[model samples]
Target: MTTFYSHLKRSALIILMLNSFCAFLQKAHEITYVVGCFENGTTETLLEFDSDEVFYVDFEKGEVEYTGPYMPGFDPSQLFQDLQIYKNALRNSKACKAIVAYGTIMEKQPSEEKDPPESILYTAEEVDKGVENSLICFVNHFYPPLIKVTWTKNGQPVSEGVSLSRYYPNQDQTFHQFSTLTFTPTETDIYSCTVEHMALDRPQTRIWEPDFHHQHFELDVFCSVGLILGLLGIVAGTFLIVKTL
Candidate 1:
């Protein structure tokens, strides 16, 4: 009787082990089809379907085994959505480096928010006239490593006055490349920074108007008053010397 009991226990253990192994094998092939299924392989690939929208095939029961209820309604292609996701991530980076020097942050998704797509950069101060105007621009993706940064005044392209910096890496393993377009625009003119980068889903843009440009009228007024006072002093000195002599 004890021998029979031991035999029963061993059979149960073997069955349990087999069940676990079969389950593992089933899971392995379920997701294997998605490894290289981007653009020319599988239509409903990994990044394409959201949670619970995946399909798997299994044929192991008898003659032919089928699995899964094909989900209803066709979803749009995932490649477009994937690019949009990446585009949004970069835009929301709030890198200060990403916006126009004089313009506020533009539209972007949360992935690029003020955190470290690069790092917590040296926060820029508000514009101080005659000191330096910090550049804020949206990087226009051109190629992989090379990009062009140029200034636009009232919709005209400029050359020879732009600055490009080395690309930095973000915490997310992506790169933070920057370029600047510099132009001293006037109130009557509109300035925009155009960049063509390689990583953006599409061309990114940030525009600066007269108000956002931070041009200070008070400074101009003070300089004008000083000039006038100096000229008057010169005139008074010339008259006084002439009279005394």
Candidate 2:
């Protein structure tokens, strides 16, 4: 999540710039690369690449190490030329130019941001056959106070009974939001709530099934029956003891 970086012509600056560039390339575009340093039997990789081919050179052995899928026919040397063009274009871009004109090596420091909300979907009340039920999509502990929540039923978008709550601040300085969808859930009904936010790379979804509610209901009934039977047995034992005494 580290973003903006300044280059001071020092080791710290070099590490900062390289890490920021790697994050920008991976997140803004799908391009990926990693830079590692090995010194005194200690190796540290500043950035990690996920799901990409890696070609590494061993300075001591004068060989290469590869771990994942690779295309042997692809000439990776072209990437150098492409990188030069990309560098020039970025330097010429308005944002980059503005940052340079500010007499700084980089723009403002990146934000210390929070992640997207934890979302859960559940029924507000006991679900009954042939009765309308309200499904609550509780989204909590997110930052920035901006999010989009949507509901779907049986793989189709639902809107009629949907409602959204205003973002509220939490004790930890984060934000929370809620969404509700009311519908008459049947045995085959499947409901889901999806939340989208700037902090998330993809939308978070939570699904609710009618069978889940039924399963919980059955568990509750079984526990209640056991408790009632235990109470009856205790009462009969007490009465018999008192009568015999």
Task: Point to the candidate with the largest TM-score.
Answer: 2
Per-model CA lDDT versus the true structure: 0.37, 0.59
**Clash pairs, model 2 backbone:** none
TM-score of each predicted structure versus truth: 0.31, 0.47
**Cα lDDT of model 1 by residue, 1-245, tens digit:** 01111112111110000001123545622212121111111111122122222322121221111122344664333324444433332332232222222122222221221211211111134543334444555332222223455667678875556666543222232334655554443457666665554344554456665553334566677899999999999999999999999
Off-target runs (Cα >4 Å) in candidate 1 are: 1-134, 138-146, 198-201, 212-245
Each model's total of backbone clashes:
20, 0
Question: What would the per-residue lDDT of candidate 2 be over residues 222-243, giving only the tens digit for each residue?
Answer: 9999999999999999999999
